[model samples]
Target chain A: MSLIAVVDYGMGNLRSVDKALEHVARDGQEVRITSSADEILAADRVVFPGQGAARDCMRELESRKLIEPVMQAAKEKPFLGICMGLQVLLAHSEENDGVDCMGLYPGNVRFFGKVLNQDDPAEPLKIPHMGWNNVNQTIDHPLWQGITDGSRFYFVHSYYVDPEERSIIAGETTYGIGFTSAIACDNVFAVQFHPEKSATDGLKLLENFTHWDGK
Target chain B: MSLAKRIIPCLDVDNGRVVKGVQFVDIRDAGDPVEVARRYDEEGADEITFLDITASSDNRDTIVHVVEHVAEEVFIPLTVGGGIRKIEDVRTMLNAGADKVAINTAAVFNPEFVKEATDRVGSQCIVVAIDAKQVSAEGEPLRWEIFTHGGRKPTGLDAVEWARKMVDYGAGEILLTSMDRDGTKIGFDIPLTHAIAEAVSVPVIASGGVGNLEHLAEGIIDGMADAVLAASIFHFGEFTVHEAKQHMAKRGIEVRL
Candidate 1:
């Protein structure tokens, strides 16, 4: 029986994430929403899901004493990050002036403030970029199993991750400009959209994660 | 991919069962909220909204149960409205698996509640539902007035002005429903929706008066709504969510089909 711990550092709605994991869990598989570092480290897999400001997310992770455990889990186990969870793994973020993150991936998170469609520059895209958008898979990864190449997922964030290593980007989506939508390297898989709220394809992705091994 | 307009199916619930009514009167039973929500999720609805029409003290628990049941099966953003009076109420809805909560009466009674809830839970989850009706006088220009209690009473607050104020108070999205147009299915109050959409920086969901796919498209193209919300059109099976999306896609509106 594999245990999947959804790391909750008192930010975002962790319940829906937990519920989605529970829905896909098999007979012996267990999903737990935990903030405890020990529980997170002991789990067979870790799912880090977060939303809110980058500075606040950093503060909560530090205050809850989860920084080391999260870093270790990303390296040791099959780790999945969602939205702000993906952003906090970066080196720095442009949110709230500028905030230093975990530096798990060598990149910076950028704000899409003036992102205008190339076709129509007069009509500027909205901030927060809230809605379902297509994610074009860039590289073959275990998490992309069963999911289509250009499946749409629900995204609700103003910032997008700019990873240094292009080879690690598993998926890319366009929102006025092309941006990295999903990143994968080793055991780590992170997405800018909410798979829990992405419907059929999203559920398939979560189901894939439950069976994914840290290869 | 960024600016795809949304098609949302709204479930107006009374007690634990989903119900449909005309102008908030003569309510007719639809089905179980959980079952309906699941079907919509499978049907590819962009989002699902639940409004507890009979928001009594006792039925609150039932709504919570409905939210939990739907959230378990349906993996989409769920917005719950009705009977939400305080921040604690918003917390209860969110804890019950609602991604966002819509506030109407309480927000008008105490405008600061919007800021307070937004500050605590973040604006992404706080939605301000404005039930508006166009009001005119001899000297004054046409203005939409905010209504409450299922559009039974007016608060005298200008809808366009209130929408801006709510956004300034940290409301992430605005659900603007026209009292005169709701349940009529003539089409959304385009002028009212256009005014609010232009006034607010945040996304505005055009609710009320959607009869067909064309009306839904009109909400996006003409009303300038970021999302088009309809009840009877989707609930009564007049148009499937997929069909509506296909129609929108053909009409040059980007939609996930």
Candidate 2:
């Protein structure tokens, strides 16, 4: 049975995440919540849940000695990061007080900042794109296995990951402005929106992840 | 772009006890509000609304207790109501860590209270609550009337018209509760919820009448509400948040599963 390790860095909705994973894995896979680096390294798959800031998350991961294992797992095994977990998969974040991150993807997390051209009719919207938003599918990914293109997902973040490579972007969502909402490269996959919270399509995504054939 | 429907959990507190049921009927005692709040927060609830059902219109101490407990333990945005009337009440709740304040009877009695609260605390912090009950047909009554004071008093106000007026007065959100369907497990008042959602430009949270995950999906898909709030289904463990979100995800609702 494929063992799924839900990485617990002491800052996530572990119960809900655990429940969703258990619900989706129909093959009787073992799902364990662990703050252990070795357990994560030994697992066949790992899921990273994000709830707070990128800085704290990265620090906690570092403090737990999980950075290398996480990077190794992302490179050699399937890795799923949700929300702020998705944001730190990038190089840096403006929200992190200019902290450098895992650099899993070549992108920087940025806020919409202040609107400079409101009367100019072309001003981009500012941060904290709270509430539900529609995600425009940009590429084919197994995690989005059952979800249709342009399916809606619940989003509550003020910043987004602006990936340097457009080909890696899996989906996009519009706020006051449109940005990459989901991304993937090799064994690494992440979404700015919580698929765990995205409803039926979200569950189906989790189901697909459990059955993913990504190598 | 069409917005996603949010599934929220409502906590009704009476003397620090988190209680659940329809129209406060068949009350099942849940745990402490703080503990319940922590669980919901752990479940990834989009937002949480705590109704101080017992606090009087003049008492501020109870509200403060509820606020302090939640703010100290829970991390999600909180909406606290009950006994809130003045601008200072709004300030106190916000300062106590509530992201928003829900004003029901007060806003209806004085519509300008909504405007003043919005102006003072910013429109984002003001939520106008409408507890609506379907009046009897024929000689019964023509439409849904607003009920206040924990459903103890009926204001005889039209639910739809009042919602529109409140929105116009700058209320940022609407927490519309169906007194009749609450705790009934019959499901949400979809047509009524849809009407209110369509009538206002702001977000509408459909409360009361949620028995199962399907009920929640219906509230979002058919009711056209931005969110759905229920107490019993969540509090009693009939369905955990993950299970509910999974069911919704399978039904194609956008929730954080």
Candidate 3:
């Protein structure tokens, strides 16, 4: 029996994430949304899900005194970071002028320019890159067990991460340019797309996360 | 691979029950919005939009229950539109597990509502729904005027300029629906959709007037819409979301199959 602590920082839809996890969680594997440092530290796995601006996410985590517990949990067990959860792992973000992040991984978050696909002026590339896009598996990881090499995941964001060490990059997706979509190293596995909302392929990643021992 | 064009099935809910005028197909319980949402999610629908057409404001809270049940089961992104006039309304929908809230008449009545929403909530959750009707006569300069109150009232606003203004006002996305072709089942207003999509930097969801799968793909191909939304086609079981994706893919448009 293991506990999965979903860090609740009052950003985005924490309910859906919790429900999706509970849907796939095996029997006796408890899943709870908690800001309690003790529960987070005691959990077998941690899922940090973020939404909204990077500045606001940091502020909420700092205000709730969750930063320490989240960092500790990431270092301790199998951790999954999603969307802003993945962005905040980097050193800094270009959004909201600039915002400092957890620095769990060395990377800088940069914005997608106003126009994407400059070659095709006919299609005015929508910002926030809001749609289903393919994520090419760059490394052989446990999470890619059933998901195809270029499976599409739901993504909605203006900024993408750039890890200081490229080896940490696990998945790459092409929007305007190929950016790091998923990153993994040791016990940590983070994704810029919301696997909870990514349908069948997404559920497969979560299922893999449940079975991964963080090798 | 590039970003795949999205296909969204919209549900019109009136007083908590999915309106039965269009989606009268074999959905076990056709009135149940959650059942319908789950069906679409299983069939490979990229997203689901709930257009709350609740006539009375008192019964507006019913839509929240519907969203709560659907979001509880369905994992895909959920968008809630209709009767979003106040910030509290936006919060209620988001709290109900909606990934996005489309502000239609409220944003048209007061453009400041869009900015206030973006400031209060993130722009990502705020989608501006524009219902515009072609006002230009055939053979004349192409132009459309914004229509409010379900295409009954004219706001005297230029549809394309208003879309740009909303984007600048911090709207993350625009849901453009053609009032003229809404129920005709012929197709979407291609030029109108093409105009607004070209005008805005945010993703535009082309809605209304989708009789068949070809109409859905046309929005992405010629109109350049980031996503295509329809109700009657899928609800009536004429075609599935899989069929729509296959049709778009064969047409050379990238779609998740």
lDDT of all predictions, in order shown? Answer: 0.88, 0.76, 0.91
Those runs of model 3 whose alpha carbons end farther than 4 Å from true positions after fitting are A114-119, B22-26
**Ranked candidates, highest lDDT first:** 3, 1, 2
- Model 2, range A56-115, lDDT digits (tens) per residue? 788988999888888878888888888877888889988756878889888889865443
In terms of lDDT, which candidate is stronger, 1 or 3? 3
**Candidate 2 C-alpha RMSD relative to the actual structure:** 10.8
- Which pairs of residues collide in candidate 1? none
Residue range B70-116, candidate 1, lDDT tens digits: 98888999999988888889988998899999998899999999999
Question: B21-108, model 2: which lDDT tens digit per residue?
Answer: 4232233433467767767767777678888877554554776777766765554567888878788878777766576789988897
lDDT by residue for model 1 (A91-146), tens:
99998999999999888899887454333533446556888999999988888988
DockQ category of candidate 2: incorrect
Q: Could you tally the backbone clashes for each prediction?
A: 0, 16, 0
Per-candidate DockQ versus the true complex? 0.67, 0.11, 0.84
lDDT of 2 at B157: 81
Ranking under TM-score, best-scoring first? 3, 1, 2
Tens-digit lDDT track of model 3 for A1-215? 89998999888778888888888898889989998999999999999999989999999999999999999988979999999999999999999999999999887999888336474776656789888999999999998898989999999999999999999999999987889999999999999999999988888899888888988
Candidate 3 scores an fnat of 0.88
